[model samples]
Target: MLIRSIRLAGFRNYTEAEIHPSDGVTVFTGNNAQGKTNILEAVYLCCTGRSHRTTHDKELIKNDHDFARVTVEADRADGMHDVEILLSRISRRRIKVAGNTVSKSGEMLGHITGVLFSPEDLRMVKDGPAERRRFVDMELSQLRPAYYYALQRYNRALKQRGALLRELINAPAASDTLDMWDAELAQSGQAIMTMRRDFIAKLSEQAGKTHEFVANGAEKMEVEYVPSVRAEESGEELRTRLEKELHRARQTDIRRQITSVGPHRDDVKILLNGLDARSFGSQGQVRTCALSMKLSELEIMKKESGEAPVLMLDDVMSELDPGRRRLLIRMLSGVQTLVTCTDIEDLAGADAGKIIRVHQATLQEA
Candidate 1:
């Protein structure tokens, strides 16, 4: 898949702009605060039906504007698709796919899938489990719509169960509701854990190879899905496991007013040469492992989707080392990529199809 073009209105600093990108790599170069990254943000909003930078819809709208709009024209193996996201300050965001309005953002999946590597991604290794979980959830949500809905159900059940647990501290009559929420959480959490297990197994394989290549075979990397509770593959068995674990943690949940067990508490462990990268690996090792995992998604997503997903590197070139940058350039073989940087020299040897300069939120071809 490729992003043929993107149009933005009242988005960030860009009052109005559009660009048709080349099939291969497209580089956006400019100084800081020039709206280079805003362009990539627009393309990514189409891919995932949300922004990577912020959660507030109003933040995307420019000053004195009540709404912001982003439209993406993408090419896939099947056909071309147009996705539009309209953000309003007073209401929820709306999405349209192929000229048809979609009630849920999850419905916009598969039309335009992408993998993004921002400067913040470098902290994936050392940051808390929340960031790692977001990475897994976003990717899986795009590839498997079923997983997306299941995750939604799981999150709702989790919230309800937590509320019930907190209420039990003062009013114990609501204890019966805990049983119902546990069943719901287990049913959905089981599905999430099963899919996450298989995904991590595949990811570990690809990341191992990529890490070897990126690290010059000096370090071995392994990615593991560490669920809060032991998980089983069979439906009945896994459901039972989740329910039992939830029951076991009910007292702790009530005391803390938090649902402490399930996929929500799970983590992705990155091991470098047999040591946990988060706790033991050096900074270089942590960054390399993170790089391997991100780059490995290119092949994994294609394998799952049957086509390459567009790549967006938002000012990550400046954060990555020369070797990692070179590895990234070599990996952009047939995939369409949008890279933003302050200077072109960051990607000195990259074969860019379009080199555009950004100034005052406008684009100019160089």
Candidate 2:
């Protein structure tokens, strides 16, 4: 539940770096471009297979290096664990736990659950539905390994079905093949939808309470999963519903050369007092809602994993006011937190205590 240390080699701006993180708040203080965020990125990559900064794995390696390695040590119930990720330019990335490779990436999750709060997260409310969907997917993936497995199956089936549909458009004789793919896609998609809806229901319950507290009981925010099809409705019912819609839009899908109906095109809606937050909420409201949602994620992880997860705060306090910053400090006081800030001195009391300075991609105990 706590990151004991992290070792990075040829990752971003850090050539060779090792950090011994404190169980309590550990601040990374440095100016811009001094590798403050890079350290946090390394930690994030170790937990999740991908990065928030970029999708390409090779971009994380050093300019001239062929690969990058990130190893994170954590303290768990049984004992300590070493989570390792090896990234290369030409080959598939490899993941190992305690020196043994794991063929499936979903197997690596939940070993070290972490919540990353970066400046970009503030846009969660204002951005398109894709960002919100990603938020739900990542949070659920960490909390429930089953969700990850189901999601993978659903996505794979979706891709194959789309390809079949594209081919059927050119040759009408392949209609029977399309029927088989439709059934498979529908079954997997239904399972995924069931998991997503249940997860979002739990998330909404926690997020509502967290948002009320963070907003000082002034505003109410709610999250809802608007699936394309309801689960209580039988698969036959779903197929009928989808068939009616797909028949109406067959020509459109052929023109676009993609599958038009399924879970892939669904979305989650966030409502603030009966109005959509993305289009109507003020800037302050949006940011606070996002923060509440993130904190709720920590709560969800704790309940699911039976321990607190590591916290990564990436240059977010700089924009928060003193009141909100104090609230964040209070919530994260006892948890392991890696925070990024330019000047810790500006933060009155909480910031001055337990600060570790970052200079030129290296960390030293303060």
Candidate 3:
């Protein structure tokens, strides 16, 4: 995958800007808050239907502007593609792919797949299970649209179930209505868990290999999918297990007023040398594990999609040690990568195809 150019208007600090990126590596350098990361954020928004930084769409619109627009032109293994996102306060955001407006957000999933690593991603190992779960969900959504729709269904059912549980807290007679939502959760959640199981199996293998490469074979990294409920049987069997578990935990869920057991409560376990990375690994180890997972994500996207996904690194070099930085650079050959950093010297000697200096929201070639 290659992103040829990105066009922006009223997005963040950019009033109007167009940038042409080379196929190899493009570097955007600037001081703090010069909109270096915002450029990458625009590209990420085109790749996925959401922002990496904020959840609110209105925040993406520049002050004094009612809308923010970002358009991306890329060349993938299949064909050339164009993705455009229009964020508006007047109505819901709109997406267009290849000049055709996409009705559902999931329809734009594979048009231009990308993998991004920012400083905040370091929390994947140090933070709670939500981080790891998000990692799985984002990657899978890009690779499989069916998985995305399944996730949507599962979340909807989960929301309804939670509301019902809350109402049951006030009146217990409605407990009879809970079985319908339980079945919905079981069916959709089973699909999600099965796919997650297979995807993590691949991720674990790739991450283990990458961790060994980065650690020089001195440490072993292990990644496992830890679903809230164990599933090791036919599809019907798994769904049945989920329904039974939800029903069995109904009293507990009513007391807490939340859906307590399912894929929504699942996690990815990261281990180093047979010890939990979140609890036992050093700070350096935690960062290394995160890096390994990201690299693995890039590789998996390439293999699964039949094209190398565009890689975005947002000021991550400063956080990595020199050796890890070198490893990352060595792995960028033949892959389209966009990197942002405060100083260009930190990434010295890497063959950057285009170097742009971002100062005062104005981009100038270095």
Clashing pairs in 2: none
Top lDDT: which candidate number? 3
Against the true structure, candidate 1 reaches a TM-score of 0.97
Q: Against the unseen true structure, what C-alpha lDDT does each candidate score? A: 0.87, 0.79, 0.89
Candidate 3 structure quality by residue, lDDT tens digits, 1-366: 888889999999989899999888999998998999999999989988878899999999998899999999998767799899999989999999998898999998888789888888878998999989988999899989999999999999999998898898889998667989999999998999999999999999999999998766769998999999996663888999999999999999999888889999999999898889999988778888988998898899888877898999898778778887787788889889899999898887578999999997799998
C-alpha lDDT of residue 77 in model 1: 82
User: Between which residue pairs do clashes occur in model 3?
Assistant: none
Tens-place lDDT per residue, model 1, 176-254, is: 8899999999999999999899888999999999888888788889999899888656488999989998999988889
Give per-residue CA lDDT, model 2, range 1-366, as digits (tens). 888888999898778888888788788887888888888888888777768889999889988888899999999877887889999988999999889999899878877678998888866778876788788888888887877887788788677767876786778676666666666666667666777788788888998888777777777778888876555564467656655555555667667888777777778878787788888888878887788888888888888778888888888776776777777777886678888889875455564335767777676767
- Please list the residue runs of candidate 3 whose C-alpha ends up more than 4 Å from where it truly belongs after superposition: none
Ranking by TM-score: 3, 1, 2
